[model samples]
Structures are given as structure tokens and as C-alpha cells.
Target: MSSLVPPAPAPALPALLTTVLPALESLTTALGIPRTVLASDEEIEYAWKDLPRELREIPAPLRGELVARMCVAVSTGLFDSAMNYIWNAAILQLRAKIRNFGVPIVAQILQSDFEERNLVELQDSRLLELSLKLNIVNEDGFFFLDQCRDVRNNFSAAHPTIGTINDREFTTFLNRCVRYALADASSPRGVDIGAFISAVKGARFNSSQNDVWVQRLSETHDAQRQMLIIMVHGIYCDPNTSEPSRLNALDICGALNSGFTASLRSELVHKHSEYAAKGDEPRHTASLQFFERLGLLINLNESEQHAIFYRAIERLWTVHNGMNNFYSEPPFAERLLELSKQSAIPETIQDQFVQVVMCCVIGNGYGVCRAAVSSYEQLIRSFSPREVALMIGLAATPATTLSRRISSHLSCSQRFKQSLTLIDPASVPSSVRATYDYYTR
Candidate 1:
């Protein structure tokens, strides 16, 4: 990847208007209009279909003229006119002939345009690159933003396909749901609370419905659904609550359910706030945790779903600190630990989350930070020798200096000696125990 720093800021828009806009206007004035107006969307499409042929037959000077003329249309608020030629003709030519059409073509286009006259006006190289990656301009690409009617018609007509949902709408619903939970007028009575708790239990395996209901709750200002989720969790975590009661059972499940749900709600809220506070990073870590929580709550067992969770978290930890740091916030870690102790979380998930955090520490350099070194020791102490040995092998290859530092610390630590001593040669697999022996020695 290129290491070029972001360009300086654009001169004020007025300066841009005074300079490039007028040059563009003069160029357009010189070209004048063709005999007929390409006014409508259909006419624009027809024009685009013919453009490739014209571009081929015309000389490079004339092609440049057309590009300059089209720039005027784009600048002058002739959206359809501009899009017709460039989006269909120029963009398609590059997409078919160019190997990596997305970023390079976009960069070239931005560079050649009058828009690039100002040093700071250019978009980030990475941002332009990623937009192409996600949009998939090649034949095999999944997303296309072109305004061609055929493409739109095909997409709309495709059936039995996974429907798309808006992150903004889901997040809006989540915030409203969380707020409603805290806004109930009075404390619950036993029967009403019991029924509420039952609904929370049902919600665990019905999370998609829960999502829709949360949106509904937001739209209607009805706190009933959300309040029940929080209420059941609160009650279930209370030791004094009767264990066998239906409400208690609901609370136990709901507590775990809300633990995951609430974490996502908080994360999305944090991200939304962060983006508003600062500009977006080119590569945003996709939140697999949010989807994983959804999958678990909804009883989804697809392998791809599982892979998405793992991949998302892996990419997340890679880009923005470690997984432990990501989840170590009080509400999440505390609840997860509580769930672990209470036998609410499945053993597999517990192992997965634990390993993920440990691996993230290795990946992101968290393990080697002087401040976190002691915390790393405390972390290893919390794990059984068996689990620790498993982690050592899993981290055979360290991606960052922090990971190497962690390896060094473990190799030298007294705790490592004690942990190694506890690794029974007979009970543990030779491969697992051998990894600990090799690392510590």
C-alpha cells in the first residue's frame, strides 16, 4: 500500500469556483450544444451506448474535448447529461479494459480533472481504492452503483435473495429501544414482570423479530418490548431471584441475550459518535460481533455466519487495537465473565472469545506495552495451563511487535514456569504441551 500522507486542505470553495469552474465554463461554451439535446434518462442511455464507438473513431484531442465538455455538464448541474457520457461510456471502457479499474482509474480521473487543481481537493488514495473494492467494478463484482435501468431492474427482480437492511435504521431502533428500557414509569409487579421476562426468553431465539420490534418500539414510543429485555436481565443476575421461576429462567437467558445486544448497541452508538466527531478512516472494521450476537440469539448455525464473525473480529482487532481492548470495557467484559461463571455462555463460545482476545493482544502489540504487561500476566494466570498452551501454538506467527514482545514476556516470566509444570505430559496432547516447552525454554 502507498504510504503517502493525506493532501493538505482544499482552498475555499469560492477560490475553486473562481478558478477551475470558469475555465470549465469557457470550454463548454466553446463546444456549444450538438444539434439535438440529450435531455431524458433514456436519451442519455442511448448517447452512452454510442459514446464508446465515437471515442474509438475520434482522435485523442477530440476525446479530451468531449471529456472537458462533459465536465462542464457535471459542473453546471446537468446531472443526467454528465452521468450519461462518463458513467456509462468512460467508466465502462475502463472497467472492461483495466485490470484494477476501481482505484487506479478513479485516481487518474481525479488527477486529470480540474478538481485536482487544488492540492487538498483530492480524496484519500485508500478511500478511492476501497470504494472500488467494495463496489466491485469488474464482471464478477457484487455491488454496482450505475444508474443503468437494466442493472436496477435485474436487482429489483431477483427473488429469494437476502434482502438488504439499512444500518442507520437498525441503529436508530436500537438507541430508542435502550432509552425506552430506562424510561418505564413504575417498577414491575410480580405477574406483569413475569410475563415480561417470558417475552425476553422468547426474544433470544427471535432476535430478527426483536430487531423489528425495537424499530416498532421507536416508531410507536412503546417501551414494553425493550423494558422487558433489560428487566429480565437485571432480575436474572440478582442472586436472590428464585431460580426455578419462569421469570427467573427468562431473566437468565435475557441477561445473556441483552449482554450481547446491548454491547452492539453501545458499539454502533460509539462509532456513530466517533464518525461525527472525526472524519471516517478509509477502512472501517466491519462489526462481526453485531452479526454474531444476532446469529446466536436467533439460533443461526451457518458456517459462513460463523466465519463472518471470526473474520470481522480478526479484521477489527487488526485495524483498531486488540480484541481484549475492544471488549475490556466494563459492561461487556463484566457481563461476559459473569455469563461464563454462571454457565450461561456455551463452552465453545467462551473458548472462542478468550482465544480471540489473547490472539488480538498478540496481533495488536497490547501484550508488550509496559502498562499492559502486568495485565497480560494477570490474563495468563486466569487461564488453565491447557488453554495457555493452546494459545501459544495458535500464536506461532506474530503479526506485530507487540505480539513478539508478549512472546518474550511469556518466555521469561516465572508464571510461565509454573504453568509449564502443570501441563501433564499424559493428559495433554504432545503437540500442545510441546509448544509450551519450546516457547518457555
Candidate 2:
């Protein structure tokens, strides 16, 4: 593992760093970073004297703090510390852009690759490269960051250095650091969630093509697009859609369904957790409610959420469409069953719920539901008695394969056997009754 702590600077270095740190403080002003990130307890360090004039690129808000630290590092010949400052400045920019506190947004940009290989941990260089893709840093910025990585590895405090970075090279790296990693500027105007929400709320759909927005969204970098998607999702679920913008927002959401259903499912638990912590929750509203919304917005982590989710599942369930196998898969279904165990389901639509479960039991499409038979069994226990009773009647009416599968599924349920007393021998066809008997036995 690469060590983050730099080796103690040479014994003679402290006094030099202490003296120059004070002198540099006179060069420029800086709004220092969090106290925790301070490299030394010495007096506030100064800004770069000749920090480059060009290199208008990604904005790093902590430029003053970074310059101070880097100056202290290079002045004292603490090459490693200097590199660490550059690397951290990049991280600070990413954090500022996404509002994510830990694990740089680069990790998310490369989520699929990292997850596939189980590379849960990443190094600074790889993260910097991935940042290019995220637009956290541009392609040109990536080249300078790559050089910074090399210099930091070879000359910075993190690892042993056989070579030295002299004043000229150190200054060049500092300029690159300032330009690429710590440009002190605001983000370029793109998608402002607040402004866009205001527009949506006002129903500003004057553009002939709503698809134009989605197309623009598709063309943007993934990180920015994802940010917009998340913002729109929040809007789509907002409780105060009493304005015209709500319709405009819904139109945008309908247009931007690019694999977002699956993404939304993945985020349900976290989003609910967010809503739970907030003071204002929209419990009574249907469309705008956050944590308590039914349907695709359900949070499986909260047992209370399942009742709403399953209720929506029933409302949306048709022979043509159903829950898209998110819960039918094993551990997820187990989680669903556990959450909904004591859930109060309406008796009127109970069989509809049972029918969906039966669809899984039958594995009509893929064997997705087959992976968690136990979860489905527990779910069936809620309305299976009524459904099995109906299936008993359906079984007697026809000898068709679909009816037989229904009969077979009913016979497969252990609860069905114990509830057999609910059915009369006269109620079902003689042949179907014998078939049920054979399966039960």
C-alpha cells in the first residue's frame, strides 16, 4: 500500500520551512482549508508568487490553502508533501463539485470497472485519470495531473525518491497544480438544479422538442448527467407539485428514462434514508411524497416501505408488466418478505398480489423468481389462502396447461395443503381434485 504519511523531513529542514513559511505568507492571501488538513502548525503560508496567469480550467476552491501548503513543502525540500498537496487539491475540487465528502467522485465514475474487479480501494493516479472522464478535470488537465503523479511518486514525501525536483521544476509543477487542480473560479454554468426546478415549476416547455433536453443530457459527461438525473428524480418525487412546473418536470422525467429505473431502484434505500432525516416529510401526498411514496420509490431497508411498495406493485401489476425482477432475485426478495411480513394488504386486491407472486413461482419469463422460493412462499402466505381457493376453482374449469400450472403452483404451497379444508371435494373437477391430491400426497 502506498503510504500517505511522508517521511520526516531531514533534521535541518524544519527551521528552513518555518522561516520561509512566514515570509511566503506576505506574498498573498488564502482562505485556508479545514483545520484538519493543515500540514503544519506554523503561521499561515503565502500564495504562489508567480502562480500561472493562463490555464483557465477546472476550479479548485481551496487554491489558497493548496498553494500555501505546496509552497511550504517545496521550500523545505519536502517534495513528497508538495505532491500530496497537488493530489489533495484535485480531490478537493471533486468534493466541491459533487458535495460528496469521502471517496472521490472518480470512484463513482469508474464504479462498474472497480466493482467488477473488486478494486474497492484506488490510488491517486488512477483516480486522477478517472476524473478526466468525470469532467472533474479535463483531458489536458489529466496530462498535467499525470506528471504531478510521477513527480510526487519520485520526489514527494509519500515514497522514497532517488531524484530531486529543483526550484525550476518545482515551480512548473506548482503552476500546473494551480492551473489544473486549483484554478480559483466558479463552476461554468450548466445545469443548475435550483434554476431548472424553478423553470419546471413554471411549466416552461416552450421548446418544440422536450427530447432536446434529454438529448443534451445524454451528450453531457456522465457525472454532470448523473447530477441532473438525481436532481430531476428529486423533482419528480417532490411533494409540492402544486405548480405548472410539475407537469413540465414529469414530461422531462418521462423523456429521460434512460436506464434510470434500475438506477433509481439502487438508490431507493439511500434516498429514503435522506428523507427520513429531514424535518418535513410528505406523508399524505401521493406524487410528491419522498420516503413514503409507493411503487418504484419504495425503500426496501425500511419495513414500513414494503407495504407501500407492494401496494404499488399491485396497482401497477398487469399480465403485461410487473416488478422488473429487482425483488424477485434472492436476497432482495428475502429483504422484501421480511419488511412486508406484517404489512396490511387490502383484501380486495389480495389475489392480484398473489397472482404476481405466482408468476414468479411459475418463472414465466426467466427463473429470476426461482432464486428465492422461500421469500415468495412467505409472501404467498399473506393472500395464498384466498388465491389457492380461486385456483382450486380455476383448476376444475379447464385442463389447459395454464390452469394446470396454476393448480401445480397451488399444490406446491405448503400453506395450500394445510388450508385444504377450505376447499370442498365437490368444488373442483374430479380429475383436478385427484391431481391436487397426488401433488399434496
Candidate 3:
């Protein structure tokens, strides 16, 4: 192999400045402008020495027309103009990032109608703020970029210069712009809302399609990912949504479940609560189903959990008391067991939950629903300490259906004892140990 050759070293800073600054000074003098109007030779030399090294950090593709203009401004010792050129370039790149992140998503996040014109019209300060909110620039990036904005406004040629920035200050400003705005050229592209919605709604996502969409969501900015999650939840909760679409929504949400941020979880809970607060029963029911399907009911408040568990218990109890109870009870029993597995039974509903489960397990005089016994056993085994206590004391509450069944039927009493044995001994409270032994014995 041929030997690798090192490139030539850059020209000396003094030589470069000497060659360019004299011509610039002669031009200013010929125009009768004070020589003091431009940066001194020393400042020019300082900037020149740092310029090549700094520009090397920026990728070649980014060294476009505006960068060329910035270089020209620096060579002539017009540091203010150079600052303005670089700042404009940074602003353009930031706007491009937002555009690639999708304007509609920005609009959704801002809760405003943000078009391309609105984007173009945003003040530099407002743009930085929006960038922070969108996570386009992280906190550190935003901090420095905001300072750069202040510099552009106060000391750069973009506006009336309140003060002059020396070559060192200009280098710092350039470094901030490049580091915060231009350096991360590989930032995630925004997912297109229209295409995403269409794909989700069009058909069931196969494994490959699921992986692709999941990866897209994983790679997107947090703000967009959050907004997309909300939209998917809405779709899943929509009564008119197709079965395939609903499955698609569930698939996407389930894949991202483990990575759900606190803010995102809060948003979901807020949206879910809104459905209840508005008395939107269909949507509320669908929202509950969405949470249940994803095993996310634990994220809901206690009151919400109580409502869900109570309704499920009521449905299972009704089915147990109806005709063909044996055949009908299994599915309802299985559903309630599944719900209980999702979270602890809420304190407010624990008594009713235990009463209904015990009633079903003990059955009527005809005996327990055989097919449904396993579900009831699983649910009993999974009971929290409080639930175990409720269950142990349930037989002592006279005139209740479960109490009457256990008192009147030997088989029912024996089944009730068996159900109590499913509860882990550790879950039995010390205070309830005597009562738990009485029930199981």
C-alpha cells in the first residue's frame, strides 16, 4: 500500500492578516472612514488563527453560501457582520430542523395554527423557546443558543450594535451557533402525521410494518412522539375506528409502553380523565377499554380503578345469578380476574370485589360454576392484604348472599374454605390471622 501523506499546515495567522488587513485599511481610508471603524490587526489575526480550526468542525456540506459570506466578513475584519451572517445561518438551520420535524406537529404541540409563514415570522427569541419545547435543542443547547440570540440582537450587525464584539467574542459566538444548531446534523426527522395516521388506519400492521413504525416513533423527538401517542389513543378510543386500526393503535402503544415518560403518562391520564369529566360515556368506556387492553389500568387513579373493578364485578355477579350461569360465568369471571391482575383492587371496592368473588366461588345450592373456578382461584391468590382481610371477614357479615350460601350449604362452605387457602399466608394480616384460620379450617 502507498504511504499516507499528511496535509500541508494552514498559512500563518500573521501572514494571512497582513495580506488582507492592509487592503481593507486602504479602502476604508480612501473612503474617508476612520481606520478605527474596523477591527485592529491584532483582533483580525486572532480571529484568523481560530477561523480555520473552527470551520473544520463544521461539515463541508454546511459550508454553504451564508458560511462563505461569513468568511468574507471575517477577512475584512467586520466581526459584527460576520456574527450576523453566522447567526442567520444558525437560524435557517434551526428552522429547517423544525420543518423536518413537521409544522403540523409543531402546531399541535404549540396548540396553535403554525404554518410555514408562522415559522418564518417567529422572532429569534420565540424560535429558541419553541425549540426548547420541541426538544429540537436540549436544555444546554437552548441555554447557549438563547445567549447567542441575545448577542445577535445587541452586538451583531443584525440590529443597531449596542457594543462591539472582539475577535474572541466572535469566535465564542460562532462556536455556540455551530455546536448547538449546526453540529448535530443527524437529528431525527419528524414523522409525517398524515402518512402515519393513514398507515395506522389503513390495515393491520404486520410484523415488519410494526417494527418500522415502532422504530420511527422511537427515533422521533419526544414532543412529536407524545403527540403521536395521543393521536393513536384517540384512534383506539374512537367508536368508528376499524378493528384493524384499533389493533394497529394498540400494537404501537404496547411497543412503546416501557419507555413511556412521566410527562407522556400524565398526558394519557389527563386525556382519560377528560373523557369522564365531560360525561362522554362512549368515549369514556372506550378509554377504559384502551387502558385495560394495554394493562395500563394501574396508571389510573384509585377512583377510576374503583369504577372499573366495580363494573366488572357487577357484570360477573349478574352473570352468575342468571340462567345458563355455568356456561356464561367463565368469560365474565376470566375478565374480572384479568382486571384484578392489572392492579390491586381499590380499597373502596375491595369488599364488594371479595363478596362477589366469594359468592361465585361458593356458588348457589347447585354448587360453584366449575369452568369458572380457576379464574376465581387466581383472583383470590392475587389479593392484596387488605383484600385478604375483607375476604376473611366476609363470612362473618350475616344476611349477605355469600354468608347465607356458606351457612346453608356444606359444599358451599367447603368451596369457600378452599378459596381462602388460595390466599398467600403472608398476605393475611396478623390481626386477621385468627379469622383467616377460622375461614380456611
- Specify the highest-TM-score model's number: 3
TM-score winner between 2 and 3, please give it. Answer: 3
Model 3 spans > 4 angstroms off: 1-89, 102-134, 138-144, 157-160, 165-179, 200-211, 238-244, 323-327, 362-374, 407-412, 439-441
lDDT of 3 at 236: 85
By lDDT, is 1 or 3 better?
A: 3
Sorted on lDDT, highest at the top, how do the candidates line up? 3, 2, 1
Ranking by TM-score: 3, 2, 1
List where candidate 2 sits over 4 angstroms from the true fold: 1-147, 150-189, 192-195, 204-209, 261-268, 276-306, 309-352, 355-390, 393-441
- Model 1, TM vs. native: 0.25
Q: Mind sharing the TM-score for model 3? A: 0.71
Per-model root-mean-square deviation over C-alphas: 24.8, 17.6, 6.7
* Tens-digit per-residue lDDT, 288-324, candidate 3: 9889888899999998899889899999988999999
TM-score of each: 0.25, 0.35, 0.71
- Clashing pairs in model 2? 79-156, 80-156, 80-157, 200-245, 201-245, 238-288, 239-288
C-alpha-based local distance difference test score of model 3: 0.87
